[model samples]
Target: MNTSHQTATVSSKDGATPPAPRTRRRRNVAVVAALTGILGAMGTLVYFAVPLYQLFCQVTGFGGTTQVAAKAPGAVPGRVVTVRFDTNVARDMPWQFSPPAPVEVRLGEERLVAFAAQNTGNEPMLGTATFNVTPFKVARYFNKIECFCFTEQLLMPGERKEFPVTFFVDPAIADDPNAGDVTAITLSYTFYNKGAAALDEYLNRSRATAGRAVPREMNQ
Candidate 1:
């Protein structure tokens, strides 16, 4: 061999270092394990996404889910807010659902509202109601002490029932920056066939589990 070629050859003891095959294999295994963990976590999230999202909305009033209260803090002395109502019956429900007319309510004052429902079908049917408020952000301050929507109703043919909703605008709404300019809120409800809205009924169970009050937001 030529002298120049011999000098060009590098050995580990002379500071020439090569990558370790074992080290490379260990790195690959670590990367695969990390990737697998990440994918598994994402899959788990996808599976629980729906119930979790609804639970989140119910707690935060996001998506117009209103607050549930045991009683109204005394209505703001002279403050009044206009509340309008809307109602709907799902297709093929065979029921007539109507909400009360717009009414002026004093902040912190308890008010009783009623909705009329009649079963026109030939057979008795069970229905449940889903409700929301608009200007959706105002939902948190709209408190319902008691509402028929909280339970399922069974109506027999030709039976007419009046559903009661007892509620109030939390006096704190007047103090909230987000609700400062809110002069009116429309409460809406849609009656659905119990089987078609089995998912929505979960909110009721969650409410019961959460008890009298639910925090507005959650980290999870």
Candidate 2:
């Protein structure tokens, strides 16, 4: 009987696993899978971080970003506000951009502003403009009706063109406690070149044409 009991004890020690240990291992696996899935989702969010943030800013005017509207506000207010214009070009873009100076208008009144762009490059170039308002706190109250920024611009060598932007300050801005003290808003634009490939193609064509020119010996 003693020998039989000894054999049973050895069998239990060698062949039997505690149910609690098996359960703990399964729980650990589930937790690891859950963490992996959460990390994957986080990675996807990080991948689209820039564009998603931009869209959020556009929708909510979270930054100094302004709003785009289909029409002007319903009523023009008696309060007058000054809008100053500013312009810039990206370093690689071979174009000149200019916006008119300041103008004052009643709040909720639609105003038309023009900007001039000239392509000083030897080849055709394309550009896209982005704009923002200063004193970012009031940006949500600014609305754009028609803006050249909605489209890409293409200009030939030495070509100059004027682009128009129509916009207004929402009348509700006067009522907003945060924006009541604002008197002037600066509208700024920066143009980015969108035609690098076009410029390269133009250069290649010019080089090919030059290769066919009369040799110096022939001219002599």
Candidate 3:
């Protein structure tokens, strides 16, 4: 006599019931929906990159973004702070920018400093500057009364101009325990060309559609 045995395939080795076809279908749909949502959020992220970065810096005084003020309150005795200057020009800017040499000032003492720029290119160009201060924690106390940054600067070929900034360190900085060790700050500016003739339109629309193209929940 010959004996034969067959091994049967079960849904699971442990004998747990398999999910029904409908249940499996629902899981597949959920997985696809999650992937779709993630892809959509990635697309929206690029749109918010630039403006969001600037806003974050400005709000938290991160990245050394400085503040604007009308004038210094008054000079504080025995509170002299060293302020260094730095300048940079974008490769395509075709302009020269050199901040004045470093200077020392008493807290709350209003001081005027000039940053000069000259067009080195043979053609007219429009350039603007972006500035920040370091240590970033001191940015709140570093106020600028006049600045050339963030403005449409038009220069004819070989044209030279002097832009000045009236600024001061607020005496209140002395009261902040976190800033007690801050004795110096460096103010730096970088100039770049945003193209010609469209400066106004570019700036006007830079933040115009900030929230329009992005959904409220995508960032969350």
| Best-fitting candidate, scored by TM-score | 3
Model 1 clash pairs are 75-108, 75-109, 76-107
lDDT of 1: 0.85
Model 2 stretches astray by more than 4 angstroms? 1-67, 198-220
State every prediction's TM-score relative to the real structure. 0.58, 0.58, 0.60
lDDT of 1 at 144: 86
User: Sort by TM-score, best first: what order?
Assistant: 3, 2, 1
Cα error, candidate 1, residue 118 (Å) = 0.3
RMSD in Å for candidate 1, one decimal? 11.8
lDDT of 2 by residue, 1-220 (tens): 9999998898798997545888999999999999999999999999999999999999897997765677776657478889999999999888989888799988888888899999998878878888899899998888888888736788889999999889888898988998988999999999998768855766677688887675854788
Clashes of each: 3, 0, 0
